[model samples]
Target: MSRTIDERIVEMRFDNRQFEQNVQTSLSTLDKLKRGLDLDNAAKSLDGLGDAAKRCDMSVLGKSVETVQAKFSAFQVVAMTTLSNITNSAVNTGKRLVSALTIDPIKTGFQEYETQIGAVQTILANTQHEGTNLQQVNRALDELNTYADKTIYNFTEMTRNIGTFTAAGVNLRTSVDSIKGIANLAAISGSTSQQASTAMYQLSQALAAGKVSLMDWNSVVNAGMGGKVFQDALVRTSELLGTGAQNAINMYGSFRESLTRGEWLTTEVLTETLKQFAGAYSEADLIQQGFSEAQARDIAQMAKTAEDAATKVKTFTQLWDTLKESAQSGWTTTWEILVGDFEEAKEVLTEVSDAIGGVISETSQARNELLSGGLSSGWKQLLDQGIADEGGFIESIQEVARESGDAFDKLVADSESFSDALKQGLTDGVVSSETLTQAVHNLREKMTGMSQEERKAAGYTAEMIEQIEALDKGLQNGSVSMEEFTEKILRPSGRENLIQAVWNAAKGLVSVITPIKDAFREIFPPATADQLYSLTE
Candidate 1:
């Protein structure tokens, strides 16, 4: 409807004041949000409390943020409609003002012009959604985007402000940067351009350093090496080696089937090797088989020693086993010995068998000494006598030597099946479950002690915030901004008002409950998590 001069003046003044107040209110909400977020979290003492709040959690804060976004979008639509009307009004008013030329009509029209400017600014900055201009009739959508940006920024500067402003991320690049994901996560935005840039840089640095984002690594087996001992073990066991004693050791270990390699074997090597091999057979098995690694390097060496022994006891054992089997069967020993394809081996076995009586005497003596608690002295005596026998007792002595040598051959042969094979299996396991499990346990332990707020903040790095601040400043200075101050209100700082509202809501909840908790912590001084959560009826 056409209005009188008085009516239009009143309308223009009222709308201008209201717009200014809305700007102030938006700034106030942002300020309160910052204050609430920064509140000291020391009073929060719940174990596993940190899990209560997550940056990615789309709960109360997130839902509220979405509501704000929807509202802002609606506000954009409303502004567009208003701008279309103002543009039409501006044309006719300009003509009428020019025609009247009287101070009254000119003054009324000037106020109208100012109101149109404000309307135009809102439409230009915020008149977009789904490829449709909210101000459907308005022709200056681009200009409206620019104007909205400048207006919001000017308002931001006027009431609420983040650290020095700047342009970041894509202001230097063409096309509007997409932040739909961010909007979905946060209900309100207080992140300045510089803060967003700082976040980007932090994210970049984390990537460059080969860190998986928190989201990416949240489910990782070892939290990307954050576990204490597990982390150290991985580094120690998996890191590439350079030339040094450590490197040499690692190489030797690897060659010897250890996680790390070593250049040379030592006494420790021999002991560990022996212990590991001993694991495969019971001591009873060793006694029955008469195997020992003490006398030979290989099965061949042990076999040779057994054959050369004075009494030939060990070789005779193989013969007795053969004889016992042959005797127990319906076979004739002579016939088998003469006609069997294994005859040469059987003939040699008979010769060793002839010496068993002599070897048994020496063997009995060694056993007697050991049973009598003189094992060391007896063993030393046996070694001292060696392979030499000066008397006619050489037959018996030789038998003992051959028995000892056979024991050594069997022990050496088992090494392949036991020690070397076992060690090799462990070294080849590419990732250790034991280490990863320990890391997960440790990370959970460390994080569980913090409050929910702290944990939420933990995922957010201040470095990212600094980068965002720098970006905001860049935008302000037009260093990297495609006129961000005029076009980028759907940015980190766009929903400051909404962010503040959420914070205030959280704070208000805190204010109501703060006194009791503070009093309780003071009086009881909770010594345990259970005590902190204790409530009264």
Candidate 2:
């Protein structure tokens, strides 16, 4: 045993030679295993232990190489079993980690929240272009939406119509009333908010252009039903002229006013007009009278068949009468009671809307408080079983993961520090080298005897336990010396000793690295070694 300092250098050189030979042989065996060789046999066999046994001369050691190979082969089996268990555990844990991250509840909730805000922004942008204030529009929408929710109306439809009504110069109160009226119309007439808005807008244009008298407009409004019949007449006349509504309104000037005075809109008057156009004049004559060819053909064909004309007339008359009855009865009395009047409804709605808005805001603030770290740990625990926002669940999970990672790191750091201290004790003569070597050997044997579960409970990861076993084996088998272990494994940062080691190692390995550096200084640079080792500390 090379216990004296004089024999230490020779032992180190011999260990280095053996370690290099073992590493080369192991790498070659692993390469063969990677290429689809029989992995179990290759891992267990000692035939791949390299030519060290032959070159070192087995007679001198007094043991045949096969006997040593058997022992090494058993260690390999134990090490491989430990590694396989660790890999399986890591894969299962990784699957759980991925599952937790992929379906993050808070992330999904925030995405939905952002989508709702985006839709609101789009509505606001569209409403703002029509000279309505965004705040006013949003407030009206909330109030009308709440009101609709309490009634038979669809909240989404009413909310949409409120924005449209406000943009078209309707006050918030009238907008709500109009939404109610339109919703009722939709129920009775199956008209959508889009169609109602177009009809109302066309009526406004007709009023603005003096085509329909103010009296007619008020009659349409005070009836508390959408003017679907009146608007359809205008649309039909426009179609007859092969033109848009505005152009039709402009060209005819007082067409709606004339219709209101007579009954160009009533069933009797429309039938009379169609009868006169049916056969009293040619298609050319109707066209000369400003009717399109398609319109003349339709009129002439309708009048040609008495049954066709009568059926069409009765259908039109029944539709008009049904709408008239719906306008008079459907929700009109309820609308009058709820609103009292349009002007009064505005004041009432504004006050009620503001109150409801306050309640909504308070509810939202309370929810935000619970999510924004305001709750106690006990409350948080209970709340975590349900929905949580980004500020709550994600933050909590991230903090726990960070703490677990930090704890694992500390465990590894403590084990490394303890090993380093043991090596340092031997160097300082606080313990004899024999005592340190025996201690390492005993630790390795104890660790190897434990099951994988027992090692895990003792805070030893697979990598840490594997390193301890391999280093002890190298020491006991004369494959690695204490000097190599100290220099490579411990890599001590004691300044003077580190500088000496670097200088000695550099002299042997990099003596001819640079001709200029060699000529300028035969010694390694202390400045470079200090700079390089500073990072370790």
Candidate 3:
């Protein structure tokens, strides 16, 4: 089996040469495959295999072969998939090129395209027959292509218009479907393709600018408020309300309903009504925040009359400033009278400032009754009743500062005794000689000399007695807050002290009997005082 050593060397050389030639052929095939496909790394791996084979090292050659095999397998799978995807589509080459080149499927009727020949082959393969019905099939395909061509032309033009907007940094994808739907609707509603695309662009711009929300855009489009009408509404609303226009759909609910019912024929009425509605709504809010009902109504009416957003905002600002200044001035005066110094009243002043600011900034109720009638009037009312103490003064102010909701109820329950005392005390000089004192004195004399049972018989209701008792009980037991008792019961009724209370009762009884005597005289013309008094008794 062993020939000469030289013979063995010759045989080995021949085999090495053949192996090198085979490696070169394999490398050539890989290079050709790389040119036809995107297999850069696979070709490089095969090149390395060729270099290894040239070295004639069996171990290195074996590893390179394994690597090349694995790479080739992956490359084959990718290549086959790519080729299949390209070949399986039912669109022509030109159309496929357009789709691929533009990266827009709407440009062509198909996402991927094939030729007419491929389509016929697909039909024949599916039917498992050839030459039969070929003409009919071609005719049907022709008709289909014609329809697809027109549709594609419209879609392509629309998408191009959309592209112009997207090019300006707009994100159409946010409402892509909605935009497409709108475009389609516009097309169907007798708008030219360019017109539909323009309208869609306007809507997209509105959505992007936050002048309208996606839902709002859809709502308008769905309601058939398309073309210039929808565009105008969006632009006008945004102009009128600024960012508030984002909620146009919700704000225009009634307007939309009217449109649906054929009640509103134009957007002008809708916009005007919306402006008025906004004004009224703002006015109502101001009223709740302490603006007098009259002032709020006037401000709202001004907003409507102005019909401009900036004007409305300016008017509101001015009104608010006026209210804030008035509140601050009023509170300042009350603070000065109550505490005698701003420094000493810092805490209360801060509270006052904050309350005023809150009414202006947050549109809260102003609670300005404490200062409305002027500090002098309030002081005269309190001082005339002889409070004379800082604590009593502050407490009286606070009671008046409370909301008016329950103040009148407390007043009705507590007024009678307070009123009577206020009348008699001022007349007798027990209280001050203020103007209120004279008024109280006259009221007290009017109720002089009457028994409780006689007063009851003279039409003083049981309910009135019950209320008076409840008020007395409330004050005695401290069930009623001092602020309430002072503002609602004391200040309003003009009663400053218990001495006034006794005087009020005395004056009340006298008033009842005197009224009875006078009425008895009136009933029996020219009756004497003694007869009238006896009849009353």
Best by TM-score: 2
Query: How are the candidates ranked when ordered by TM-score, highest leading?
Result: 2, 3, 1
Between candidates 2 and 3, name the one with more favorable TM-score: 2
The TM-score of predicted model 2 comes to 0.19
lDDT per residue as tens, model 2, 1-537: 546875888888999999999999999988987777776677656555555455666574566566688889998999999999999999988875554334432343233223323434545565555565646654655554444433334344444444444444444545454454434343344443345454444443442343445454554455443355435434565555444555535556754544444333432222223223224456687678767788767545533442232122244433443333223222333343555333355578889999999999999978865653332322232223221222322233233334434442333245554344434443454433344355556565666688989877866666655776676677679875555334332343344365788899998767666786766676665467778789788
Could you give candidate 1's per-residue lDDT for residues 1-537 as a string of tens digits?
456888999999999999999999999998898778764453353323665644346687788999999999999999999999999999988875445433343343333333333443343343233243424413332222232222111211111111110111111001111121111011112223334233323322333333223332222222221223222222222222221334443555532232223322222221222222213234454334433443113322322332233112244443443233223221222333343313243456577776895698789977865543322222122222221122212223223324435432343345554223212322443212232223223333334455767746665334433443443344346464322211221122324456778999999999989998999899977477676567431
Candidate 3, residue 111: the lDDT equals: 14
TM-score of each: 0.10, 0.19, 0.16
Can you tell me which runs of candidate 2 are displaced by over 4 Å? 1-136, 150-154, 188-537
State, as a TM-score between 0 and 1, how close model 1 is to the true structure: 0.10
lDDT of each prediction vs. the true structure?
0.35, 0.49, 0.45
Clashing pairs in 2: none
Worst 10 residues of 3 by lDDT: 105-114
Better of 1 and 2 by lDDT: 2
Model 2 C-alpha RMSD to native: 44.2
Worst 10 residues of 1 by lDDT: 157-166
